[model samples]
Target chain A: MTTSTFSERGAAAVGSAAAAAVGDGARHLIEKRAAAVDAYPAMDAMRDRVREIRLHTLAHLDAYLADFADSVEAAGGHVFFAADADEANAYILGVAGEAGAELVVKSKSMVTEEIELNGALEAGGLTIVETDLGEFIVQLSGDRPSHIVAPVLHWTKEQVGHLFADQLGVPYADEPTELNQIARTHLRRIFLRADMGISGVNFAAASTGTIAIVTNEGNGRLTTTAPRVHVAVMGMERVVPTVEDLGVMLEVLGRSATGQSLTTYTNLITGPRRPDDDDGPDEFHVVIVDNGRTAVLGDEVSEVLACIRCGACLNICPVYRTVGGHAYGDVYPGPVGSVLSPILFGFEGREELPYACTLCGACLEVCPARIDLPSLLVNLRERVAQEGTAFSWLDRPLDAYEFAATHPTMWTASIDGASLAGRANRGGWFKRLPWRGKTWTSVRNLPAPAVTSFRRWWKKHHGA
Target chain B: MAAHTVSVLDATEGPIVVPSGSCAAMMIDHYADLLSDDDALAAAARRVAGRVREFTQFVVDDLGLDGLEADATGPITFHPSCHGLRHLGLRGYGERVLDHVGVERRPLEAAEECCGFGGLFAVEMPEISGALMETKIGHVEATGAETLVGYDMSCLMHLAGGMRRRGTDVEVRHIAEIIAGEDEA
Candidate 1:
């Protein structure tokens, strides 16, 4: 089986050749996040309060789900519960059918990406375009988003220059201003003509049936207002009990996301366009998609669903900083991806994703909702290790180590054996290995297990 | 794991010290949970965990970096492992040791980052591990320091391994090894 994650192409992107660039990019983003937190000393207190709020909400999630749906219906908006991706896509397509929509403009929404909504609409013979600039860039490049907040951060502007020249047939422009102007000119035309707009809900308040969407660009506001029909797709967990809870979540969202005090736009849409409203969509629909989140609700690791999607975890994750997102082989990447993907999908194809991290707990530190990512990762690994297929080879050391650790006699012998092995290498390390340890030794040296066990030394000296 | 905890309980009394922070974290933070189902084992774990300390913490608190002699003279960089700084609350201890010992603790670029020796993770995702190591090592060289000290051995082991494979002369040692007056290169 393929044990290593570094395929030929992935090796080049995150390997030594580009490691510096990757590290710098990650450091830059995390520093911005840190500065925002540093600027607001009370961020930790706010983080805890919101975490408690989410903890309470998630505990009564079954009740709240019904409450939310009822409130949405009462506010003159339609609420559809979709159980899986196909179901969600089918429901949204049916809504498009009922509305007789020709073109759909989408604000940047990860859940829509999660359900592959654009493809479903396109297959049903409707044109769709992503209105977020970063989303627009990845769309044109035919690339899945490499990051949650900044989708195309993996590609340099020079590469985008080439992509635009080749794909858009526009004059190559490397400057941010020029490229933005070019995109604005192109998407602005589409925004005006779109019959339906689809957006992702950052947070939904159950009490008033208000949907909150955050954006750095004006596109989200325009997408909801200009289109005649508006459909918002949200992962089922993206709801809070009231508007006040949305305010506290918003406090952490922008600061944790891009270090902005608040995003350029935080659209709090209450129902569709009202009769008194001058400019807005006439029909509003909320698609609360389960897509496997309901299954995660009562599990031991259920707290993972409390994620605010601010992506603070990704910015500080060492594995994400090193390998980049595409290597994760999942919709979400980094520490959160490792936990969320295996649970949502299954443990079969994505077994290695949970093992991707060093379990550093960096993600937990920056998390706005305070998800204990490292603990969840270890628990996931423990579950994986429970499988017999895991013990065949890769985890042999882990299994052996567990046995040796518990068995004092065998552990002592192994220590003595390592002591003997250390004598052969004057440098005091094993330069190569005789077994599958080549996975480790091929790139670096293994310190010989301490020649004399610490217990043995303590007994010899201190008479324990 | 239960039997191991019993053995540890039989052997230790108070103030058990581990050289590596990751080991200390497992003992201090995880053992109780690992033995949670059994009340007796869980209580025993909590007792043992309360006494557990990383080497830096032991030296600074119990031994009190008050009178320790300064040993290493050259410029030194400190690699703060993820487990040590984040999990076990290990920061000021390393600085206190370096300060009292009169060693020059040069700040590392990305000093709080992981060196990517995640036990079995190095084997499972070797490319990502190696790439992270490359970034950390590049910063170590940029510091122009002759040696690197860390609170955890695993991180140093990974750094030392990468340095050996790359044939770089930068040396790696645990903070205990540094304070104990060992000259390694």
Candidate 2:
């Protein structure tokens, strides 16, 4: 079994070498994003438009889903509503079986990652290849994706060189151009030989039955068209009402994800190959995976559904930059994951994930969807506090604190008593502390309380 | 607890001056939500929240003070605590005060980033918190400023602790403390 990244040993390994790389990468993305937003005068207005469209679609999701399904079917494509991962995987597997597919190529899809679709297909005795360059490296090395946009961000080029040489039996090349060429040469063969392709839907337009797949490497286009059978797995919340709404979302998504005015390829697939079309999939199937999104929609954090998977939150999250993504131990990492994970996947085992944030509000500022991430984190913390499961140690101490705070005498006396104690210590600093406070003193010395309590000073000076 | 705080704040006749930026944020941003179940209490919380102001914010905006002329120790860099900077919109209050004083203010790189002193978070997840603190301190060191100042004491204490442990002699002070020009207590 893989060791938990939250384990003491696992956490200690983070924040040193990884901090530099991740911090630099995040800084680079943020700088570019700032420049892009600065250049586009209507960027903020477009963000508002995208947010309204998403919230509107979510409010009437049933109608939109029905409309999307009908439109897809009308255009000679099949749509299956999967209630959970099991149903989604089963439907996709059935499609592959009916098509007599042995090889499958997949584009970059976080929703597919959420469903663990690749493992399910591989388990069914089909060879699967990740066509996106970052995803391909992650697939070849058997490593989890460390970032949303840049999946293998934590992997250095030297490491990729080693991975390629060992896994692909090719000469080790550390330069980015050489590495890109190697991956392109390798994935080209898979694309030609693959019988089925699975891709993620970035934004599925309900009005026209069109699904937009945004990518910089053009791999999404290949994955959708190269194979005879194409399957698109989308989180149910990915749907928007109209093609115009899709365009508005696309505008923010590209600028927010990687600072590009527009990605190199934005493939809008309406249906399967028509008789008039030259090259496209012979058949098209869309698996709209609800998984836990509908449940989340009824909850307080329904606003998170408006997210277009831009990865802007991760790029600006200070904690994400410091500790890296695997520390989150979820399919989605960074700010969005912290709020969405515990709520979607029960908070029993991974309760600490929500508390991982500093509530810095950086994610809120950069989020293209304008999701209030810090407030959501605090909301989850309130839940954790009420449950008293994740932070059971704080329950009694907080109870005492609440009691003292409620009582004026106890509050004053405690402050005065702490002040007296502080006056006894030299340098007014405690290098070591007892019990639970040692976690703090273990890193930095704590300042002692003031020699005179503020209340006492006020009374002595003003006699009020 | 929120109800009790709201009642106390409601009884107050004057503007509520909060020395800590985070506490001011808790009142202004969260108190109403915390008491949302009771319409009267929620309204009272909002009233009190409107009156709440951080120390430097009160000094600059409410008092209409441009600057305080005082003898500062050395080259000073400011750290914008997250709550004061983002929640309360106290971004320029302290900086304007420092500028008025004619002190040498070195610009902090990534000044808006958090110092990782998130109350219980500092103790709960010290590994990650310490990592963030370390990165922030590294930025502080890069500025080569002798004194680091911010409006929030909690952030100052957290960064000061990390600076102490790292053996950086840089003094940590609240913006008010620097304005007051008080010696170390």
Candidate 3:
């Protein structure tokens, strides 16, 4: 069932057993991430260096973006700078039409999801297939991806088995190896017959004009090479100044993402099929998507673009663990999404995203790039308050609290009143409350104020 | 509010000890930045910031309150509140204080995970906040501890409210209240 609004979705997920499963998966990854970082002491230094590299690259993005475009052209590859999602999709459709592409296979690309590229392609009459196992399951099930690195982390084996039986008309099999074989058998045919390949760029090296695609499965290689035309979609911030910078980025990305020293395959595609190349796409295209990135770059939350899409923030975020990804109601979820979504998609109706977090700062702790997530979230909240969208309801109580806080007499009077109320409650605790306070009382009781104010006690004891 | 706080605190000669972890963090980590525009208040904020110490940190680290004695009902678990643990870099000041008291301390699972009492967070996003509290309480119960102690009163009250609602036997206590050897609760 589709839930409306983020709060409704959050309430639904938090109460379900799925929350537990998401928590377990997140914890498992967190363990691996921690162990991987601990095992390689150099990774700590690399983390600091990568953050510097990302910041430096972003600072000189204008110069580097031009250099990147020039390098791609020099390497015999076409580059398209898309100001938004529509432009990105329109250009891709133009390329596909020129190639007369009918079937398209995609390696996992969050940028494509951000742009809603798959739906646009299918609408443009191209049959699209997701080559990533997790993404394939998500597509077959008609469900949105729930995690960054592991999209199907929310799905159980039994659920996938049932989805396969219902969607793929396959025999029921829940065993891991059997499930892998079924998906492999089903996807292998699409890989060969696919006319166009679409993949996401993990890192776009500006100096060399090489786009790196890191994947555990070999689908990234096949998706980039098997088809007659290859297209790479990347967020413009994915660019790094030098190939050496790309190496440091890759090191931190692998350790923080899945706790692996490195992914099984890291494909660095420079250009399309060359004179000496045995295999590759004939036409290579790179779509550098802006899609609100420049706006974010200008904003105070620009440090968020430094993210490498490592889901460490998600795995370590207490809020994400409880509500899962779907509750975020956006393509990007977790701490990064909370800050990015509202800024990217206007904070008009999406004001709740920043408040959804508890400002735990756990995300910053685990973040490989060490983006200050709490500060960004608080900044968005300040904007939301200024916009007066959702937080208007809080104005009255806050005003009263502020009044009480500023005025010593009123503060003392309020304290005395609350102390009297507390004295009325049995054992100085309230089992339930009414009105706005019902939010807390709905799930938990509140501690009543003490019978005597600390000031009163101090004065009486000291006889002051 | 910060300016008012600084003005009031500037008159005091003693170190200003903040009992709440989040409050202490705000004073130490954010005050100077918030007041930087006013040169006088900025210097004063820094002075207050330097003197500010989390209650448990001050007791254990500054006062050198070692080898103390206290009493509690059964094994207890501690939930390190997020602000104190991360911002103030409170490394087991409360736990070390408790160690001196010689209470049987049971390890709380995922001790560093937030208790979800993020100021307005519990009231604004109740479902998510309650869900996190339930997860935290589950670990607290799993420790089989009769008492749960934490540095922040906000987190303790949140956990206590959830426990009261669930009819769980675990009691919540602030580390200060426990250190004071009070039977109130």
Which portions of model 1 miss their true places by more than 4 Å? A1-13, A16-23, A389-392, A448-464, B183-185
DockQ, every prediction: 0.60, 0.66, 0.68
Task: Give the lowest summed-lDDT range of ten residues in model 1 chain A.
Answer: A1-10
**How high is each candidate's TM-score?**
0.94, 0.97, 0.97
Report lDDT per candidate.
0.82, 0.87, 0.89
lDDT of 3 by residue, B1-185 (tens): 78888988987988788887899999988889889999999999999999998989888778887656676757888888999998788868788887778888999899999988888988888888888898899999999988999888788889998998898898888887777777432
TM-score of 3: 0.97
Cα displacement (angstroms), candidate 1, residue A315, comes to: 0.9
Q: Kindly report the docking quality category of candidate 2.
A: medium
Residue-level lDDT tens digits of model 2 in A1-464: 12353435225646556555777787789889999999999998998888889999999999999999999999999999999998999999999999999999999999889889999988988889999999999999888897888898777888899999998899999999999999999989889999999999999999999999999888999999989999999999999999999999988998998899999999999999999998999999999999888899898888988888888898898888877777778778888988877887778666777787888888888888889988888888778877775767877888899998988889889998889887898457888999988989978889888897777777786797
Q: Pick the candidate with the highest lDDT.
A: 3
lDDT, residue A154, candidate 1: 75
Q: lDDT at B183 for candidate 2? A: 49
lDDT of 1 by residue, A145-256 (tens): 8677777767777777788788878999999888888888889999999999999999999888899999988899999999999999999999899999999999999999
Q: What is the TM-score of chain B alone in each candidate?
A: 0.92, 0.92, 0.94
Give, for candidate 2 chain A, the lowest lDDT window spanning 10 residues: A1-10
Residue range B1-185, candidate 2, lDDT tens digits = 88988998799888899988999999998899989999999999999999998998888878876445666858999998989888887778788888888789999988998888888888877877887898889999999999998988888999988888889989998888777777433
TM-score of chain A of 1: 0.93
User: If you score just chain A, what TM-score does every candidate get?
Assistant: 0.93, 0.97, 0.97
